[model samples]
Target: MVRGRFAPSPSGRMHLGNLFCALLSFLSVKSRGGDWILRIEDLDTARCRPDYARQVEEDLRWLGLAWDQGGSAGGPDAPYFQSRRTAFYEEALGRLREMGLVYPCFCTRAQLHTASAPHREDGLTVYPGTCRGFSPEDIAAREAAGRKGALRLRVPEKSITFTDGHLGEVTEYLPTDCGDFLLRRSDGLFAYQLAVVVDDAAMGVTEVVRGADLLTSTPRQLLLYELLGLPAPEFFHFPLLLSPDGRRLSKRDGDLGLAALREKDSPEEVIGKLAYLAGQNPTAAPRTPGELIEHFRWDTVPRQDIPLPPGLF
Candidate 1:
């Protein structure tokens, strides 16, 4: 059976862009008679809130996008929240450590910013391997200086290739593109790359459908899957939903959030608008989730970022 998921970070309410991804993910699985899972990616405790998480679930329910497993639904894999799954991340980190593929990185954000690191299009700076070859004495010295280090995976200079369900074949070099990346943060929190890979594999997720913004992240996650001996799922990265001004919709854009949209529009109105944006429907007429699924086609979805039509809200 094909198992899919819509993992949302509950730092804020769901925006139109987030709803677009969730609807696609839901339709892709449901249309094919597959199970849909809803995983709350509340890893960043400092920013993630219980109220936001609760609101997220309510919003999805209101939108008529339900999941088969995870969150309140429950499944074989319990504790759907990433914050509650730290032990799994630690175990995976321990395996990497035993294999000599993990190292302590003492590079502070200020130090990294000053370093001549290659910047990716997504705005992430590639690590310069400053602490990749750190010795025990070197690490001890840094610890003595009251500096706690993060854990980084020792990425080899090799290329990785994978076929995206929507975008076709994609390739990236590990060391050159995204050098030894972080598996754990300096504050002892597990990084997204590590946590996501571990959770997907453990939960038996067969496919991953997310935004194209994360297309560059697939290669790094692929490396983790190989290192941790986990099966990498098929990925489909859809185009992002941009604002009328060509900016990506975010939490800062409060007017574009579900909380704001709910006050004026019905669930069908919201779903219909997003479906039209995703190239699934001919018109932006109100439609149910099941009604839209009949027209959901990966090829029909645009490859480029879509600008939100004027007066969409």
Candidate 2:
């Protein structure tokens, strides 16, 4: 079956903007008789909370979105949490290590802030390879001193490009425009790019439906896949939900999350409103998940940012 997933970090509650994304992903997969998986991205131990994870499911259920597999209720792909898949990331990291595609970096946040290239409008920061050549002695000394460091991918000096299903023909320069990025942080946690690439491949996800905020990072992820000899998943980056002030949607706006909306809004109305926000017009006031799926269309979904309304619903 064609597969898609709605992976949400358990760091915060699900909001209206993200709700639209969830509905879009769920409906898209179901309409085509595909499987929709839910992966809880609780890799950030410092930020992820068990309560928040449970809240994610509750909120999604409240919004009428369901998944065929994943999460605490495991399906075909058991052990869905990224935190539980440490060995998987270690194995992938080992591959890059053997291929000499990854290197140890001891740069501190302050050092990186000073060394980074000018930020792009899309928030691209080229990281100059500073500790890419740290000798064995240097690593040993740091270990002895109990000083922690991050592992960075050795970005190549070439143009990385891919055709996005929604955006089309996306491209970016890696070494010059983008920069070598972290695979593992000093806290011994896997980086977002590393964990996502590893998990998606392991889960056998076919299509990835996410917001456009991640469009620029595609090239880097592609490079990682090529290095690991893994097939890349098809991408559909739809419009991001934005704040009324035209900023990208964030958890800070507690007023936008589904739980916050449920206090005053009807679930059916909220779902239909989000469908319309995705550029699909429902024929009737069908108030269930099935009806929303019947009217969802990939082509009709808006490709630009959807402004956060003063009130959702």
Q: Where is model 2 poorest over a 10-residue stretch in terms of lDDT? A: 280-289
lDDT of each candidate versus the true structure:
0.91, 0.81
RMSD, each candidate, Å? 1.0, 1.9
* lDDT score at residue 58, model 1, on the 0-100 scale: 93
Q: Give the clashing residue pairs of candidate 1, or none.
A: none
Residue 183 local lDDT, model 1: 91
- Model 1 collision count: 0
- Candidate 2 is scored at a TM of 0.93
State which candidate has the highest lDDT: 1
Give the alpha carbon lDDT tens digit for every residue of 1-313 in model 2.
6888999988878777678778878887788788889899999988999899898888878767878889878876678888888899999999999988787788777777783456777765667778877888988998799888888988887998889888889878787777888899988989889889988888888888888888888888889888988989999899987788898777887777666688887778777777767777543243667776776677888778888666544
TM-score of each: 0.98, 0.93
Cα lDDT for residue 289, candidate 1: 95
How would you encode candidate 1's per-residue C-alpha lDDT over 63-151 as one tens digit per residue? 99888889866789988998899999999999999999989898778888874778877888988888977789999999999999888
